[model samples]
Target: MRFSLIMVAGIALAACSPPVPDSGQGVGFGNYEEYQKQQRARDAQLAGSALPPATAVSQETLAADGTVVASNDGSDLAAETQAALGQGQSGSGAATAAGGTGPQPEAVYSSGISQENNFDAVGAQRSIESDAAKIAQNRAQYKVIEAEALPARPGGDGPNIVDYALATTHPMGTQVYRRIGVNLDGKAARNCAKYASPDQAQSAFLSKGGPQRDRMGLDPDGDGYACGWDPGPFRKAVGG
Candidate 1:
């Protein structure tokens, strides 16, 4: 009876106790160890595929005297650039030699006139003395032309009208000669129409009994003019 009671108490105590938790089935951070293992694998893969480190550029340094210390790596590049420049210059020279010649200098011309703004320079070239000398030279070349006598009239029995015009001093319309006829104005108009000009009429009138005698009745009022012939212009020309 005592042994059976002890066995029953042990079974009851076991049934009432809380269950033991599974290592893989906890509420928080139960798979933290597995996560750590996965993280380590990814890190290993990225490390294996990483790029190589970049090369460092060579830098120039300044000396204590403030002079630049150029890098040795740049010396070869500078030498190659200078060699290319020298080749280009030589090629240009060869092309110029193949052509006939290079550009020529511009031609300059000299002028008699001065280009300076100095008034004294211009005054020295042209003065009152120079102008007087030029005037004297022109005067020495000048010649006075004496008035020549008029040519004699052609041989004709008729009186010269020019002489009559120069001789007359009285104004026109002053009765100079006696006129007696019927319709003398009408006769004069008809006779004057026979001549081409007043001068020609006067010449014909004087040729045939004009001023003193009315043969053709050309001088109607007998002012010694025929067909309104004017002597004023002829007198003015000679200052009579």
Candidate 2:
């Protein structure tokens, strides 16, 4: 009975011994696999939540020789874009054609001047004719008034004194003379008119009295006056 108890105790101790190293390695591998699976799931979730990748071309991309390549479905998108672009270009072209293209040069035009001159020769001629007419009229009027003459006076040249006296005294008239009939030793004194009327001559002679009687040697013919004026020639010429 003691021996049987010892064997049972040995068997129990053997069963309680630590596992092998390979067995521990197997357990670690299982834990590592489980951790990798969890990491994969987390990665997938993050990827889904993040923003999408960039598609446009930037300057950096161009420098790197990375051109933008449209997707296979981008052909249809390109066609639509091309149609819109064509429409815009057509509209712009129409507006430009109507508005005229490029900077318009400044407008230039030729300038010309015209001159005209006119003179009224007829008016000048009329003025000259009027002046001639006035001059002729004035000459005619003066000739009519200056036609008469006068008797000569003493102590000056012939007729000139008479003309001057006529022009100054009577202007336009006749002359006559009368004798005083005064007696002298050798000659007789005669009285004559210096004016137009015979009565005027007689009055002048008598008013001064007899010529030699009043003042001797004053009258050459012993007349009352030194000079005698006669109007016979003037009257005969004028026929009045």
User: Model 1: which ten-residue window has the lowest total lDDT?
Assistant: 55-64
Candidate 1 ranges with C-alpha deviation above 4 Å? 1-118
lDDT of each: 0.83, 0.50
lDDT of 2 by residue, 1-240 (tens): 999999999999999997656653346576666778888999999989996569843322121366654444545555767997999887886777888884468999855432222135455446777989999999888844565555545763322322323333222222222334445322313322235654344334444553224332223343233344343455455454
Q: After superposition, how far is residue 212 of candidate 2 from its true place, in Å?
A: 99
Which residue pairs show collisions in model 2?
210-224, 211-223, 211-224
Clashes of each: 0, 3
**What TM-score, over all chains together, does every model reach?**
0.51, 0.16
Candidate 2 accuracy as TM-score:
0.16
Best by lDDT: 1
Q: Pick the candidate with the highest TM-score.
A: 1
